[model samples]
Target chain A: MNMPVSQEKKKIFVTVGTTQFDELVTRVLHPDMLEIMEAQGYTHLIIQIGRGPEPQIPTSQRIQITVYHLKESISSDIKDASLVISHAGAGSCLEVLHAHKPLIVVVNQKLMGNHQLELAEKLHSERHVVMCYPETLKTTMTVFNTSSLENLPINNQMALSNYIEKLMGF
Target chain B: MGSGGHTGEMVRLLSTLDFRHFSPRLYLVARTDDMSAKRVQQLESSHISTAGLFQTVSISRSREVHQSWITTIVSFLQSTLECLRILFYYQPDLILCNGPGTCVPPCIIALLLRVLWIKRSTVIFIESICRVNTLSLTGKLMVCFLADRSIVQWPELHAKYPQTVFLGRLV
Candidate 1:
């Protein structure tokens, strides 16, 4: 008689939001990073490449990998993810934080305005997310700890509605 | 509403509204943005109570990313004319927009209409949550003269610009 072993599936979802961040995409798809992610016990890797170049898979990887260009909404992906590694876009960060999942925000310095850097740094300082530059992404991933993360409060949607109603005299 | 970030936040904000009170919502999208239209449909359909109460209109983009200054003037003027036509026809009671380059022309037109005794449409501008320390170009331009009320999601921005109201992360 043999005992059945239950296998757990852990997924890491990487998103670059609507804008292209080729550096973050390329760095995440590197074989070395794949090895690191696998070693960290992530059984599945999903990448939302956005407008970046298509990913090419290396033949020798044991973990499962899925890549797609874009989606109407990434809420389901964020829900399924055990960990989310995303670009420092405000929308993506807020969505992940709203889900109360562990998040690693990788800043794209090549972006023209570079407002993402400030946003990411602020969130990191507040301990809501782990912020790192694309160059340091690998190191950050290797040392990432989910228990250190904190969830941001759900926003009061009524506040804006009430204010607008009062201003509009409704 | 303009780019994906702006559209996403606006949709989330509007989802909280009482559609019956704020009926006939008009969403102005940038000509270059196709995603926002689909998002609008999703938002409308999800709330069956507000079906057919809101619609989206496409306006020329005021400026494209990395556009040169000289060509920006031409596009800006083109968009301003389009906004003028739209606002003249609708004359909405309230115009709500977050910071996006596409919002600038419409807000300016709304302000012009109110000043000229044409029709009063209150314009509200909400700064993007991404702006932590400083204001975006659109925020700077609208804070003083364009918007009837300017709101910021971050205390830092509200403190720096006393003109902006802090609603504590509306988006």
Candidate 2:
């Protein structure tokens, strides 16, 4: 079943967390990729660029794309988004998951350690998110479709709360 | 809280606390760490009915990635003083933190308070799930002496640090 027109018009939020993922940002902003997103019915794209230098975004009268430098709060943006394309930062992943949005995690291999890839692999194995390498982002987005987003398991808050209660000896 | 991944893990762990029992919780974050503070506020508003139940204070960050030792030392001293002041005023019964350089000062100060018989706040240090094979620098420091209870997400780490409890992944 197709989503209602209003729901389909919801923006896609692309965030790199506090660090820059220039490669991912570049792929996302590519005219061809943006066209695919536009075809998918995303009317607007909101990107949190973090420390990455601003990419030359192609002008599209059809889809409105806004770039933010580094936001202290992107919760509202996350909430408003139908899909989230984020870096493999656990913070960004968790926030996207908690919001119950469809997520695509792009790992930055240039990081000091390959830890981000480890996390991406784990989450991908769990079917919690789709994982893509930074270099392969364009190909991933080219084939991107909404049906790829499986329904996430319930938020981990209740289980975490229960555990904390037990730990606190309550 | 530090920033990025550590803050995310900390937020998930904090979400599980029975806030009714742990009333008036205080969150200590780095002075420039807007991300952590925003996250804590969001979590509280979503879960808890009480408006003022969660309070946040910004303290100095102990170090930055790839920063020099001299910069780290200066930041650590400043953060340590801030931690002492916050602990003295708030006087929380239990202090819970995850792996982050920012967490070190508070954990150390809490230990000092307990040793000096000033205040006996239990410090619980949870190693981040990202540390699959080994503990982070902050985790190594706290797991040995400062933290009353040190928890690890991965069993391999638990084997390495037998004393630290292994609970499954919180995130």
Candidate 3:
């Protein structure tokens, strides 16, 4: 008899667009770990998907990357991803969660010089997106092999009701 | 301050300034056609005067429009006429313009009708985004341009326009 492989099958997709916030989080993920990620048969990896800003660092060949600006353009890609990493801007988070994809969100503090940190923290507390702050990023990525979108918080029914309330009042 | 950086920050700064020493009537103009101004009003309801023109038109012949010369001509005429009506009525002591292209005509009127009753009526042009880059472009022509003081959110603007003063980020 054989044991199941230690790593779960993985498909990862990343996005940081619509706001200039991605630069901070994008700085951290090194291009080297695709071996550890790929060896375990983590099937796919998608990174840095946004059109506005170009990457400051070089990219890794182990994973695929797409810089998508419009929400409609990202549908099939998110469906193919197991985990979605992104900046904590409201619009991007809505798109990730709309697909019921697992998420790790990083907010951009340097660009607009405003309250994106607060917005990120609020999302993490609400269980909508996992916080990818400076310290937690490493642990979060290592565990990426095991994580599944099924366990992460994605409440379309609840989100739709909340979105409707926000719309009706406006 | 209606919902953006320059306008939002300016409202807070004005609250702290010694306005008690000088009488100033600050009117927050809204473009009924624009959403940013509406969000701004919601953010700072207590701080600004809500009355101003409700119509707005863009500074484009058309974006992604294959053909619209007829529509563009009609909008240009309508915007010009409405602006004339606003300038004659508001006569604000100080015009603080944080924009949408809607502010253009009223501001042009403010400069054109310089009254001797006041040594100078203060008009401040505030820029946060590059939506209408016209304000920066105009500094080349007028010695003391559209607004008596031009306030920009980006510090880089100060270097570009010697007349501009940089205000810190709008929340």
Candidate DockQ scores, in order: 0.77, 0.35, 0.04
Better of 1 and 2 by DockQ: 1
Q: Write the per-residue lDDT of candidate 3 for residues A1-170, one digit (tens) a residue.
A: 79887554477666665334455435444553455446545556655544555554345455444443435246676778876777765445655666777788765555543444554565566566777664566566676532333332322223222322333333
The model with the greatest lDDT is 1
Per-residue lDDT of model 2, residues B61-124, tens digit only = 8887887999889989999999899998888888888878888888888888888999988788
lDDT of 3 at A62: 51
Q: Write the per-residue lDDT of candidate 1 for residues A1-170, one digit (tens) a residue.
A: 78788569899999999878888888988999999988988889899999888877676897888999998779999999999999998999999999998999998888897887878998999999999988999999989988887888778678998998898877
lDDT of 2 by residue, A64-136 (tens): 8899878767899999998899998877887788788888899888888566676677677777888998778
RMSD per candidate (Å) reads 1.6, 4.5, 14.2
CA lDDT scores, all candidates in order = 0.88, 0.80, 0.49
Clashing pairs in 2: A161-B16
Ranking by DockQ: 1, 2, 3
What is the lDDT, from 0 to 100, of the residue A104 in candidate 3? 80
For model 3, residues B1-171, the per-residue Cα lDDT tens digits are 332333433444443423332233434343432344443344344434433333322332111123366875676456556655555554555655554344455566666666534223456665633311233333332225566656554445556666766544322
Order of models, best TM-score first: 1, 2, 3
